[model samples]
Target: MNQNLPCTEPRPIPAAKKVTRRRSPISLIWIVPLVAVLIGIGLAVSAILQRGPEIELQFASGDGLDVHKTKLKYKEVAIGTVTAIALSEDHHSVKVSVQMDKRAAPLLAGDSRFWVVRPRVAAGGVSGLNTLLSGAYIALDPGKSRNVKRAFVGLESPPLVIGDMPGRQFVLGADDLGSLDVGAPVYYRHIPVGRVVGYVMRPDGKGVDVRIFVDEPYDHFVTTATRFWHASGIDLSVGADGMKLEMQSLLSVVAGGVAFGGGDASNGEAPVASRFTLFSDQTTALRQPDSIVQKYVLVFNESVRGLTVGAPVDFRGISAGEVSRIDIDFNRRASDVAMAVEISLYPERFARQQRNRPTALPTQQGLRQILDGMVAKGFRGQLRTGNLLTGQRYVALDFFPKAKAAPIGWNRPIPELPTQPGSLDSLQEKLVAVVDTLQGTLQRVDRLIAHVDQEVVPEVAPTLRDARQTLARANAVLSSDAPVQMELRDTLREVERAAASVRDLADTLEQQPQSVLTGKKASK
Candidate 1:
């Protein structure tokens, strides 16, 4: 058989030459995008799961806050963002929905604070505006506290113009405007710390009770002995050299602030809570003791002059504390008015550094000895007015401590309060004395007039008749001679001189009565 001849065993027609082809470029394009889409979906799921927890906050007003756009921050770091905001079912407040990061979850404790901050125009300067452009965020503070549930009130309520509250809370009520517009300041010192939160009517509708929130640190300054009063507005003060009213802020023209003064302090007590308290942390200030002689109260037989609340309680011209309370004591047998006051001392000035060694503490007898020494001197409590225009009062303790002259029994009948120089009571007494003297002098004048009418007038009448007869004869003679006319002119001139002298004397007496009668120097 020739090689070229085909074998009967079928030459498998070279199985249609199996062809090898490359995948199309277009297919690869679709595959690449599909893989990218899957990765993106996975990333989105992760993001959703990472968001931590959410809570609701109620606010009376949303002044500077916004939903979704606002962010939550902790320690000035953004911790979460607000998701939504809606009105409550009752339409009384705004309910804000917030989502926080998981990392911030543990920090959300029961004592955690939450308050919306906007542009704050305060006595010092404008603040919180950066939060606006930077996006409103929630600020987190991991305060040192034990509780773990987080809840807060959103305050749109302004601060208190006067008075104080014990804890943090929401705005409950407000007062209807009385005759005065309630915009005066609430100050801690000269520094403005808070505002008029609002006002409300008492259940019985007797008077208005104003609510105020002093921000933390400043809030802690208030204690049982703390006093409050209205600063009113700037007053024009005039003196021999100049006149001015120390008005600084135009915004404060209508607005007012509250102030701090006294407290019944404890030793080494720290601030109760640091974050989100209605008032500032006042514990530090309260624990301190005063260096100067501290006065507890000053009473007067009458109203003390220049005594006002928020007035500086001075010891040797240095302010240690302020007057806290004022009330009257009315007893039928009492001769004078009773005033009650409380004072606070500076802590740092009086506190002593503790030694490492343990030693027996002073006994009650030793403490009494110290106190007795303080009381034995003139160092006693008194009252004085801060500003005459405002009539605000303050308490001042005299440095000279005297022995316990009067037992300070709680239930004992309070005696009359001591009066200041030229007090209201003294002035009233002087006025009464002046009136009595004037009455006596008037009675004497009346008697003199009666005598003139009864005796002098009757005698003069007879003399006048005799003169008339003589004058008649003279008239006949005068008709012939001119000498009578000259004599008449001279008589008229003498009468005029006498009248002038009497008028001069009356003017001198009226202008300088003290000089004429009492020989005392008179005020110009």
Candidate 2:
């Protein structure tokens, strides 16, 4: 019984000896580690909150983009930074990762435009020159639309005009694209007011269409009758007015440019998207459109050698129109070849202008009536020399009162205008006749001269020899002092005295015709 109790008591005593461990306030050292862990978590959250969104931008080249170094700028203010650079999947472009500032997040829109800004020279002169010292950067242009976007494709070149510029866009149709270039200056009276933004070939393959932008105040000057011309390079023209040199500016001369002016501004501005013709030069652009052109066919009986498509068709001394076409046709009835000249005539050139009258002429039927009257008045077309040195010819329409009458038939495809021989041709014919007459006269004169040389010359020589021999015989007789010569001298003296008396009497009669009939009276 004592052993069992002792075992129980010892267990109870052993349990008491095991000290009770109490959890004391956590140690300050432990608190330090926990606070540190909490601080680390707070810092991580702050970092997450501050980091900006990453966006992908594709570019034609990575020329000026640099990871961590290149920046995206708007109005010269940094808005984002490039973080990475990589080749696109197709390897045709460069993929750039940009970290855009939170403030710039709204700018990442579908219509937003971006381009790398580096030192470059363009028709507008040196651009992005500031980038040379500060290194390259990406330029951003905000869009007007509200559509949001993340991925973007950058432009290879900067836009001609930046965001929402106040201007008007006009399309100019031209036969060819001359010296015009992107960013080329557009001048108004030598003042830079706009720029050439783009150009494209027409779908019909007929011509090129140039797109231009004119600034606000300048756009107002463009009217329905406005003219546009290529003003690039130095315009050197040598014409009847003498040498003329024209240029918009030195920059225009070097790069290329355009000019617009000459319009009926009194009618107000030109409607937007109005199609206008682009001329090669200012002279062509400034030509007046003051008349309606009527087509006519001229059947010429003479050569059309110097006549060209653009030859001037004149009425009297004034230009009425231009030559359109020239062709040869066979006259089946007459079995002869005839030359047909198609001409466009503007009746306004010769028609008397009434005071305050409209510039445009009447309709086709009215023109036909006028032409018919003119034909009855002996109106005829003839080719005439325009420039003697260049051998250029023009059609001259004139009235020939004495010419053979010929009627213009209304049944022809084109109204036929009668033609007469040109002045030059008539002059040539007269000259040929005169040359024939001169040749005949020259032949007769040559025959006369030959006759004189063969007959008259020989007779003259024999007569001269006989006279000389007679003179020699008289001289020999006088020098020898022969008795017969003395007797002849005495006889000559007596005859001379008698001749003197007759000469004195003739002188008296010559003084007065009546001296022979009446005795001369002496004056006191």
Candidate 3:
């Protein structure tokens, strides 16, 4: 009965076709779109969380750095990206914020350093041009320290204030542009170590406060006894060596560099302060006149024809140093003009190289002896023209080692150099003396000529005319015949014999003047 009823009830529907059911439109419109949107948002959130924390760094310069466009690199691989850029409160520096990849977090330490890589011009060479085009990056030089919460500074340019570990301190000063101004180099066996710090006028204006720098091992290497001198540029000179000086860079004209070294503490007992100042500018404005003491000396039988205040005080023509100051002394004791020259010599320039050799030789006495011997041994002083147009003069010392040597003492009289006329004054005096003597001699000669023409010539002319007339009359009388000719021949022979005898007598008188004089005196 139930089957019959179902059949009947469905009979009306079975006469048509089977119906297909459709899903809800609301689910297709809202739920599927929601699921896709959720997936995208979840992916974005996960990516952001995985990227990790960002760091902020401050910098004094950003010359080679870029924000967002530049990356932070470690081990030559990019590890972070610059996220933002802003100015610091002081406005003197730039603050850069960097977002590091999560994978790189462990690599960073508290002591990690960040410096800007930029183009640098140095005496050794120039560097960092490739980085300029790529934009400057944060260069991470991780340190050995183990602190977890770390901070770092991003540099825009190289640091003006250099750092050195625990050792000596080389305080360097700089100009506004940060260029160094010094005459010499900080060298280690001719190798460069540091640069000249700019100089300042001392408070009292008596001197300059110079600054220099030394890094680590080199700082320790340059001990208290270290010596500094100008090795910046070529100081060419034409002398025994023909040319002397250093010529390295075109930039040396406006700027200079330094070098250092020799040996460790090889220098004999260092001074208490261990600091020394070197100067190359010899202008009076840069010097303290009273800082140096000069003594009055009487140079008896000695003359400095070519010596000057800046002359090289040489020992055997090898320059030990220069004559710093000079003065003239009126010798009340000896009634002569004396010269006193103060000289400062440096053994360090050469001594540093030979530090390991032996005891430092006594420079004062040894150099004195060498100088004394040189002067006595025909070592002559002469003036040399340094610059023709400027008329700047320098001193030259030449020696003949074979000449006689002289003795020297503490206040010993400087031996006279071989004299040679060089100065304008000396030359003019000689010319005047020569001209005066020549004029006097010419006047005397003219007077003698006039006397001969007016007195001697006239008197001798009348006598000579009379003798010629007498000879002509005698010749006319003797023109007669054979007897005259024979007589003339005999007379000629006698005349010849008399002339020979006169010549012999004159020769005897000339040969034995003393005998002739004695005979003449006796006759008188």
Candidate 4:
């Protein structure tokens, strides 16, 4: 019975375990992190694609620039960043590598320009002042060309903005550089309209050649007759017009500048790269009003100590020319030294017209004929004092009727003007003659004084002695008393009675002339 019960229980327990399968919510932990990882991968891919090109810049110096810190700017806007700085292979310059922004990609061209922006004081003015506090940066000027590039040569100094601006270029010639400098402003009627870009000594080394740029609208004022002058620094002149202070502007006084004007706008603008002379000052620019110039030579016999190059050559108080050269030449054949002066005359300077007219000037032969006529009429050249205090002299042409008649000497290339002694020379000669005459007169006076003392004085003493002796003899005779005196008195009385009788007879004859002749007229 126990065995049977155990078998039955075992069989029933095994079939009852058919339990139900339960369904649970999925865990959200891994979903958030998976989505975030996918987003990160997409952002990284976009960043790699958007990166701009890298470029290399060569510069003389790495001053004020820092790798990974310095920025590239265009129009004061950041456009790129400097990523690396290294020395060039030659070690003569710095090699800077930059990574530009995507927007600035088109700016990389063959003609692009780069320069460091630092505080600078130039002839133009004070610039890049903001860099003083904000720190220095690199500046970029986009090229106008279409060609692309990756390497560029950097400028040591900032280039003029006129490179892309509308303007014109011109060349000016000057005797000297004066105070002019690169970046010096160019003015029109005291208004700044351009600037000087470069300067160099001419091939002949006689003058300086300056390159200038004039901005739009104002460049039209420059014509063939336009005049340019140095307006740099201050021009202080104490003259007949009193103290004259001239300057283009206050800035010009400190930084130097140039001025241009004096052309009629109606005459049309001068072509590009036109050449003009740069006068030293406004006065000099205005001095050469005429276009036609004639050259002549003059030989002076007197000392030319006070004469200098650029001395005025005047005709009757009117400025006619300028002394171009003053030299002393010793003639070996003649064995004498002569002072030769070369001058350039502008006849149009004396013309009544304000503007020069196109006309044929007198030829060399015609000039010779005119000079001959003038010489025959006593026209001569002489040196005259221009400034007595400075002892400066000038050439003067005038008519002197008493001057010796001379003919024009055409032995040299240029016709020689007849010369006579200057007024100062004549005065010196007169003084010398006066001194000689005075010397002769003094000698004669000395002789006259000697004759009076030696000859006249001795004769006067003898005459005085004779006069005194005669007076003494007369006195002795009057005072004498003797017998001869008594006898003389008696004789004198007898003579008196006889004289009375003769007088009575003369009276009777005078009363009766007929009685004296015929003794019959006694009745009277």
Candidate 5:
């Protein structure tokens, strides 16, 4: 085959056409890097969308706080975190920047409250114990308003009573602060039902205004007649009735507290913020105001040593009045001083005792007439010892049937009430009079003794001498060996012999009753 084809001159072999292929926009190897870039961009956008609101909180101090670790808790659940802390423009406080989660956005009301929760010691008690282990953090007590706010002023301490708590608030007007302070407990029937929230000086600066909170269920106990008093320290009162001790609790005794009661719960519940007077004690709070007071002056002619101002003026063992003042005056009829005691008589006391009471108490003029009639009927005033140990005395209004009649001095500036000597004074006067009579009797006894010694003794001496002489003679006659004795003995023997002869004759006559008008009875 090669010898025949060689004559063609070995034509050159045609070259193969060059092949051109279009490439894809991306290579398989480059697709891996593009996917990674897309994932990174998506992550960055997600982070931007998840960002939260930032708020500034001005605080007095940055105590127990870290830049980024501190958290804001609502009911122990973290809702936000502290991002930054720096000094305020005024340099007086620290400004804290907080980033709040979107979920907690609704809680940022205009009235929302913010405070630092640390281990706190207050009048209420030790709180924030959990913070000791978890470290200090910010706490939130949301407001009820719909308005929202961002920047807020942080409180140095937690509020004693949270606003959202189920309770009612009331204002109390007080004369002084005493031991009462924020967190002081409020008691009803010795049970803790509320707490003191705050206090401030009055605008007049004459007193203080205290705010208190009472929890639900117990708030219904407050009524128009509700009475409040400071149950502080030991409520100890020693009076004529003896000693009384009342305390709500041990904490009340130490830190002080407020107690309210003695009102009928059936009455209308006092509205929140109702004004009430804060009494110093329960007694004063519960005491009914005395109306229809009648003042009278009692002039006493006896010593009022034990009687003092403020002494009770009791009538029939019931207190009707009190001694308001005491004054000394020269007695017109006697050489000693007299006492003028002014008394404040509450006529309502007598009216309350009447089983069939009148619509109203007696008028002043009618009261005077009544008093005048009573005085005519022997009504009198006297001082009686109330306590022997304390020597305290009280005025006693009583009827004295035998007391001399004395009319009231109506013409004087102050009407005078007739008064008799005090019970103790009467006894003292009786002792004095008895002693005087005894002294006079003793003088008479002395006179009698002197008269007997001077007048009767001389005459009695002579008579005694004569009696002695007569007794001596009688003694001589009675002597056993005297001649008179011998004669008397002989006469006695003669009489005995005659007596024997008579007795023998009587016996013979009796034997012969018929022989000699009846001889003596026969010997048998």
Candidate 6:
């Protein structure tokens, strides 16, 4: 075992040396985190620097809106997002903050409008139905104004004419709204061509002012001479002329609509903000204007049961005027009640047919003279049954040559026209008179019958009884099964036999005259 002690003396341990490790400025382990932090900082700066502007929207409600989810869109393009929602200072509305993209900043202006789009059914039609499934969203209608805006009041309803819809607005003066509503259709020749935008009660509260917009090409049809009327429902009229039914369209019947048309004369294009009158119906709207109207009152001592406002005042079956007002007044002086009927005569309507018309438009002296002459000739106004079914009556003017003469009163504000009982009234009077005469005659006949029953009937009673007995006996003799009838039948048979015998004798004489003289001639 060569385990002999080798050089057991360990060499001197190497002296300790200073080893200074070169220190790198940055450690490789930290490099990754540093780069990461730097990238994060850069992204944050970009988000702050490139951010868009923010605006506030005031809405009556916060319905169907979600923070960070609701979006504002224009032409179906998303442009902004709802960031915050809070109640307004007055607690009357919900104020929403929207962060709009820088690209959409240019579209924000004072006149820009915003509204929540949802399923809505209006008179015009159903709209915003697509929003039912996709959820309600804010809709933006960019304005033409250039003024910048930071806050805006949201619209409760979507605009009827959104964006730059090519149209022109017109004003209509109406006695009342009459079923008209915003977004109602405007019709031309039964076709929808526009929409009602607004309606306002007049400042004086006397009527309504309706605003409507007509599309570009259809606007051309609206001229100075065009007539506007309510075409809201079916017009069914029955009168002396008979039944008349007029309809515009099925849509117009349900939604309420305005219709326009022109006469042969359509002068020029109506101005941008032109104003027109809204008549009750197409017939009234298109009728020629009555420039010369003369009003007159008629006093009648008889009943005016079937008379009504708008009843036609006919001149020999031709329409000349209409009843305007019917009133009743007490007369303390005469102590008699009478009906006061005010009628308007369109003198110009008849004047158009005259061979010579008045030279000027103002004065009506010539008309007065003509009416005076007519009155002198026994011409007067009378109430007559125009329609038997409806019991409608109308004023009729005709010449009554046999009637008593009456004078016209031309001094009052509304001239007084002489009136006479209607033909029906006269007929009723005649019938009543005839009935009275018949009643008197019947009374006299009744008295005669009573006298006969008391005196003459008693005296003739026995004679009448005897005559009845004789008639009874004659009836008994005439009976089929009586003895007299049987005896008569026997006599008739005997007569027949005798006649036969005479014929036989005559025949024998013709054959042999000698045999007739002979006693008898025996047959074989």
Which has the greatest lDDT?
Answer: 6
Worst 10 residues of 2 by lDDT: 6-15
TM-score of each: 0.37, 0.73, 0.48, 0.70, 0.71, 0.79
| Tens-digit lDDT track of model 4 for 272-341 | 9999999988988976567788787888877998788888888887888889998886789999998999
Tens-place lDDT per residue, model 5, 257-338, is 9999877867789998887888999987887779567788998877677777767899998888899999987766777777
Between the candidate structures 1 and 2, which one is better when assessed by TM-score? 2
Off by over 4 Å in 3: 1-53, 58-67, 87-94, 101-126, 140-156, 159-228, 237-243, 248-255, 264-306, 309-324, 330-338, 342-440, 449-524
TM-score top scorer? 6
By TM-score, rank the candidates, best first: 6, 2, 5, 4, 3, 1
Candidate 4 residue spans exceeding 4 A from truth: 1-42, 162-166, 200-208, 234-254, 271-273, 289-293, 327-337, 350-368, 411-413, 434-524
Model 2, range 414-501, lDDT digits (tens) per residue?
Answer: 8788888899999999999999999999999999999999999998998999999999988888874877788998999999999999
lDDT of 4: 0.85
Clashes of each: 74, 0, 15, 0, 14, 0
For 1-524, candidate 1 gives per-residue lDDT tens digits of: 79998778656666577789987867766888998999999988887778787877778866556767787775577778788888888998888878888777887766565766566665434657876677555454454456766456654522332123443322312233322233344565667766554566769875456655566556666554454444434535432113456442454455533344554454222243221112222332244444443334455445644454445566556555655556675656856555454444442232343344325434546644654565545446554444555555455556533324643332334322232433344566899999999999999999999999999999899899999999998888677456787788889999999999999878877877877667645566
lDDT of 3 by residue, 1-524 (tens): 56566453344454667799987767656888899999999998987877856877888866555667888887669889888888889898888888888887875677666777667775434666777677666777665667754457754444333322333435322222222354334555555555554467667666555666554456667654444444455545533223445543454435655443333566553332255545342121132223222222213233544455665544444554565666675779879875554445455433444648546644666756765665666665444444444444444446646545544335545423343334554676899999999999999999999999999998899899999999998887787665778898999999999999999889878867887556633433
For all candidates in order, the CA lDDT equals: 0.56, 0.85, 0.58, 0.85, 0.87, 0.89
| lDDT of model 5, residue 190 | 89
Q: Model 6, 199: alpha-carbon shift in Å? A: 1.5
Question: How well does candidate 3 match the true structure, expressed as C-alpha RMSD?
Answer: 18.9
Superposition TM-score, candidate 4 onto the true structure? 0.70
